[model samples]
Every structure is written in structure tokens, then in C-alpha cells.
Target: MMCETSDGDPGTDGGAAEAGADTGGDDVDEAGLAQFSALLEDSTEDLYDNAPCGYLSTLMDGRIAKVNSTLLDWLGYTGTQLVGRKRFSDLLTVGGKLYHETHFAPLLAMQGQVSGIALELKCADGSRLPVLVTSVVKTGSDGQPLLVRTTLFEAGDRRAYESELLRARKEAERARADAEAARKTAETERARLHQVVVILQKSLLPPELPQVPGLQAAAYYHPASTDQLGGDFYDLFALGDGSWSFFLGDVCGKGPEAASVTSLIRYTLRAACLHADGPAEALDMLNTALYARYTGNDPRYCTVVAGTLTPRDGTFDITVASGGHPPALLLRADGTTDFVRTPGGMLVGITSRPDFITSTTTLAPGDTLLLYTDGLTEARTTAGPRYSEEALHAFAHSLAPAGARQTVTALTGLLEGFGNGLDDDTALLALGVPAADGVGVT
Candidate 1:
């Protein structure tokens, strides 16, 4: 397009020159051309000097040849201080210099380029600048290396992020380790406590039933929990006279306090049976001892059936005393069962003077007498009700003619069958006379 002058003349020298310049012809304006060339030169130089990222050109041997103002400003250096005076590795920290020589230089020489190499640069003030750098070998047209062009981006934010992430991970690992140690410690303590409970529980009962000359005796004990102490206890020991003293009882509660009471009862009964005249008198003595010892608002009491077994001709005379305890079951060889009842016996240790009662029964050959704590009759059962005394009597009736050992074994099976339904401690003692053929099981 040709420009017309303001007076509409197309042939004027000034208008012709303006049109030639706009169209890139020979008659262009030298002043306008000079101004355009200057502006383009300044812009190109400004772009390189003040780029967002640092830029530098280094010789093949790493000596600094040219560096942009952006990079020089970052290092607080003048162009005269670095250009031709320093090498690329000299601008790096000591570790960074070693890495540049060993890893970066070798990789770049082989690959012709390296990207995203993280390094630290030494600042003029003895501080450090973390950077991610990339470099390329600028080659001549003949394929010979000329110089290395490098760009660097500051990496302080990224470094800070990585450090924070590492710290959090370490803390999480430490917390898990601490929790595992605590759990293991708790488990060890629990196991130790359980062992102590087992030992203490054994000390409360007879180690084994003694062998009575003519009578076959058997006993069983079951605890509701492995870790807790049970209140029920049984003991069969000699009176040192011609007779034997035996007792099965349950204290009012469970644990160490109840165990203490159980121990007291066993010892007190043994002593009382030896000195007192009969089973009833022995129970009365026990009541006196307990009442004298425990006399506060927090009174400890127990239900007990204690007895003396004195052997006679072809049989044993069993004189039993009850103190608020369940009646003993008598199973005979004649396929019959009965309860030796003492109806008005009071709970031992509740008053200054409490009443106890006596019941006498003869255990002939093929007769078994069973004494038990209330844990048996009060146990929960699959039938959806508490196993009452009536059920126990019926169960015993089914096992008539069974010996002491057989009876105890059967009842132990029954207790196990209750599983979680049986939540209380139980104690069982069975005494039987042999048949004519000496066929008592135990």
C-alpha cells in the first residue's frame, strides 16, 4: 500500500519514503529504521538479562563465559567478578561441586543434556540457595561442542515441603512403636497376674482328697473365670480320731477377700470338729468364731455343710450339719434318691448367736452321698432357667447306684455343658461305700 500526503499527492518525496518504509522498499526512512533496530536490540538483551529464571553460559571446561544479570543478581556478583574469572563448579557449595564433577559432568558429557539436577549454590554472604538446574551442550554447525547453556530454578519451597513430609513420617513410625510396646507390656502383666490367681486359688482348696479306708471319696471344683479367685471351697481331712471331718462351702462373694474367709472357714471347721461333741456343735463353734471375728457393717458370711464320717460295721454313720446351705443328696443302690434335709439352719457369721441344724444318714454299701455349694443349683442352663435344687435331685436320681467317682465325673460333665451359662464357682464332694463285690469306682 502506498501512502498519500495530507494534500492527497501520491508523488511527494516524504509520502513516497513513508510508503516505501512500510512496504520494505529501497526508499525507506533511515531514522525510523534506526529507531526500530535499537528497540529490538534492547528488548532481546533485556529478556536475557532479567529472565524469571537464572541463565549462564560456560565454556566446555566449565569456566564462566557469559552470565545473565538475573543469575549475577542472585549470587550478589558483578559481571566482572565472575565472567572469565570463575568456573561453574566454583559457584557451587563444596558438596555440590563434588557432585557436579563426579555425576553431573559425566552424565551431561555422555547425554549432551541433563535436566532437573538438584544442587546448592554458595551465595556471597555465606548462605545457600537450593536450586534445580538443567544444562545443555550448545554445539556448532559442524557438531563440535561450543558452550553449555544452563538454567536454574530456586527450590527452597520444595525442599521445605520434603523435610516436613519426612518429619511427619518419622513421628508416625515412633508413635506406632510406642503403642506396640505398651500393648505387649499390658499382655505380659495380665499373664503374670493370671498365674498368681491360679496359685492362690489352688491354695484355697484341698490338694487331693485323702483315701478313706472303706469309703470312696471324689471331689470337683470349677471356676467361672481363669483370672479371678473363686469363693467356693472343699476339704476332706482326718480328725485324727476314728472319724473324718469334711466340709463344702461358699463365701458371700468372690476374690481375695472371699478367699480369706474361705481359708478361715476351712481352718476353723477343722479345729471345731475335733473339739466339739457332734456335727451340730462343730457348726455352732464355727458360727461363734465367725461372728466374733467379723462384726462390722461389712460382714462376711458363708453357707456351709460340714460333717463327720465315722465308719461302723459294714457302713458309715454320716452326721451332717447345715448352716444356710443346700441339703445333701443321697443316692442309693435301690434306684432311689432323697435329700437329707435340715430346714432351719441360719447363715453362719450373721449374728451373736446363730442356729445350725444336724441330719444323720447311714451310707451303706452301694450308697453315695453328694454335698455341693449353691453354685450348682443356681447355675444358668440351656433350658432358660436357673438350675434349681429340684433339677439336681432329678439328675441324681437318674444316676442311682453310681459310685462317688462316677457321680462326680457325671456332674463335672454337666457343669462343662453349661459353658457360658454357668457364671459362678462350683464345688462338689461325693462319698460312697463299696458294694459287696468291692466295686466302688474311685
Candidate 2:
């Protein structure tokens, strides 16, 4: 398609000659052709120099023939520094140069054109400019290689955004790892505390049960939680005389404070008994000592039964003094079970000489005495029914003729059967009668 002036002038020698037919016709034709060629050259040069993106021409060997103003300003270089003297590869970073040789150049040669490649161009000031470049081979009519034309685009903002994103991701991962490590550390510390609670809890009980001559004694203690240090305690110790003192009691609460009072009661019992004569005298001493030790606004008291089982030839003399404790159960060889009821006693450590009632009983052959904390008779039932004293007595009756070891095992099993319902601590001490002529457990 040809575009000419509507008047039919086409920057042609014919039009000029027609007009010049009246004047300098030969000279006008020559001048018009020269001006037209010069204008064509100038317009082509200006389009190449001022293109929006980069424009370059490289020989098949990658030498730069021409470059545009946009890319020249982008690299902070002039045409003198780039054209003819420098190859396109000279503008690439060290890594970019290596990549061009290993993959880019080979790929371009095989595929004839490579477009929109990410690269870094080095400036004369020793700084780098990130860019996306494209190149193509200007093949001739027969498809022979001629020159390489390339375009370049700036990429500073994209690089900055990606760098920030990577930084944020790394920070998030670090925080997640730190949180996991903290969780594991806390769990480890809790386990250690549980272990300490277990040790401290065991410390509240006797190291070993006392050996009663001519009698077989066994005791069981079950803590509700390894995490909680219990207030329940039991002690089996020999008195100054030929008698032995035993007690099983529970504080009003559980945990560290109750544990402290439990320890006090144990030590006080031993000390008070050492300073006294019989079970009744021991209770009197304990009452006085405890009231003097811990009777205040915030009271610390316990339910206890201090008793003695003294061996008298072919029999055992038993004396029990109660301080708000449950009655003791006596299982006989005749399969008769009875409760030695002791009422009207107050909790120890509350008042001075709390009227601790004293009672007496005789232990003959095949008779078993059981002393326990309320954790037994007060155990919660699955039906939410309370385990009454009568129910415990009935259970003992069913378990008649059971020796000390068997009775303690059965009681511990019962305590466990309460499961999560057994919120309190339980301690039981069973002393079997004389062990059937000292043969063994019956």
C-alpha cells in the first residue's frame, strides 16, 4: 500500500521534475532524492535509539553492533562503551555469564531465539542492574544466521519483594520451632515435678512396718495422684515398754500443707509415746503436745487412733484411744466381726487435751485387727452411694478368716476399684493374730 499526498505528490523525482519543468528540473530531482534518503536514515536511527525497551544487534559471535538509549541509560553506559567493542556477555554478572555459556547460548543457538530471560547487567560503576532480556537471530531469506537482537527490562522491585517474602518465611519457621522446643521443655519439667511429688509422698509413710512379735502385720497405702503429695500417713513403732504403737490417720485436706501436718503428727506420735507409758497415756501426751504445737486461728488437725498390741503369753492385750477416728474392726477365729466403737473424741491439734477416749480389747488366736483411714468406709460408690461403716463391716465379714496380707491386698484392690471416685488418700494397717501358733500366714 502506498500513501501519498492527496495532491499526488509522493516525494518522488517524477513529481519534483513535473514541478521543476518550469525551473531547475535536474537540480531539483537530485536535491529531493538526497533529502529523502537523509530523512529516511535519520528516522530509522531515531526509532532504534529511543525505543521504550532495550534494542541491540549482536553478531553470531555475540558482539554488540547497536544498542538503544533506554538500555544504555539502564546500564549507566554510553554507546561508545558498548557498541562494537563489547559483547553482550560483557554486561552479564559472573553467574549470568556462566549460565549463558552452559545453557543460554547453547539453547539459543539450537532454538534460534530466546526471550524474556532473567539476567543481571554490570554497570561501569561496579554495580549490578537486574533485568529481563530477550534475544533473537535476524536470519536472512535462506534462514542463515545474521545478528542477534535483544530487549531488556528492569527488575529491581520484584527482587526486593521476593527477598522480603523469603525473610518473613524464615522468621515464621524459626518461631514455630522455638514454640515446639518450649513445649517439650515444659513437658519434661512437669514429669520431673511428678517424680518429686512421688518421692515426697513416700517420705510421709514409714520406711518399713514395725515387726510385732508373735503377730503378722501388713499395711497398704494408695495415693490418688502422683502429682499430689498426700496428707494420709501411717506409722508402726515400738514404745518404751514391751508394747508397740500403731496409727493410721488422714489430715483434713491433701497437698503440701496437709503433708506438712502429716509429718508433724508422725513425729509427734513417736515423741509423745516415748514420753508416756500406755496407749491412753500416749494419747494424753499427744493431745497436750499437739495443742501446744498447733492450736491457732487457722487450725491443723487430724483424725487418729493411737493403739498398742502387746503380746502377753498366749494372748495380746490391745488398748486403743481415739481422736475423731473411725472405729477399729476386729475379725475373730469364730468368724464373728465386731466394731470397737469409740465416740465423743475430737480431732487432734484443735484443742488442749481433746477428750481422747480410751478402750480395751483382747486379741486371741486367729483374731485380726484392722485399722484404716476413712478413705475406706467413705469410698464413693459408682451409683454415687456412700460407703458406710456398716457396709465396710459387711465386707469384712465376707472376707472373714483373711490374714493380714490378704486383707491389706483386698482393701487396696477395693480402693483402686473406686477409680477416679476415690479422691482422698487411704492407709490401712492389718495385724493378724499370732499367725496360728507362729506357723505362718493362715
Report the number of the highest-lDDT candidate: 1
Candidate 2, residue 130: lDDT: 85
Query: Residue by residue across 1-442, what tens digits does model 1's lDDT show?
Result: 0111132433345654565567677665778765554544434456667887888888999999888888888888899999999999999999999999999999999999999999999988888989999999989999999989898888989999989999999999999999999999988998998899989989988899999998999999999888789889888888888799888888998888888998899889888988899878988998898988888877988999989999999799999889999999999988799999998999989887788888899999999999998888989998799999999999999898889999999999999999988788999999999888655665
Q: How well does model 2 score by local distance difference test?
A: 0.79
* Model 2 bad stretches (over 4 Å): 1-89, 99-162, 169-203, 225-228, 253-257, 277-281, 312-317, 326-340, 359-367, 374-400, 413-422, 434-442
lDDT scores in order = 0.87, 0.79
Q: Check candidate 2 and list the clashing pairs.
A: none
Candidate 2's error at 120, in angstroms? 4.9
Candidate 1 regions exceeding 4 Å error are 1-120, 130-158, 184-188, 330-341, 376-401, 410-422, 436-442
For each of the candidates, give the backbone clash count: 0, 0
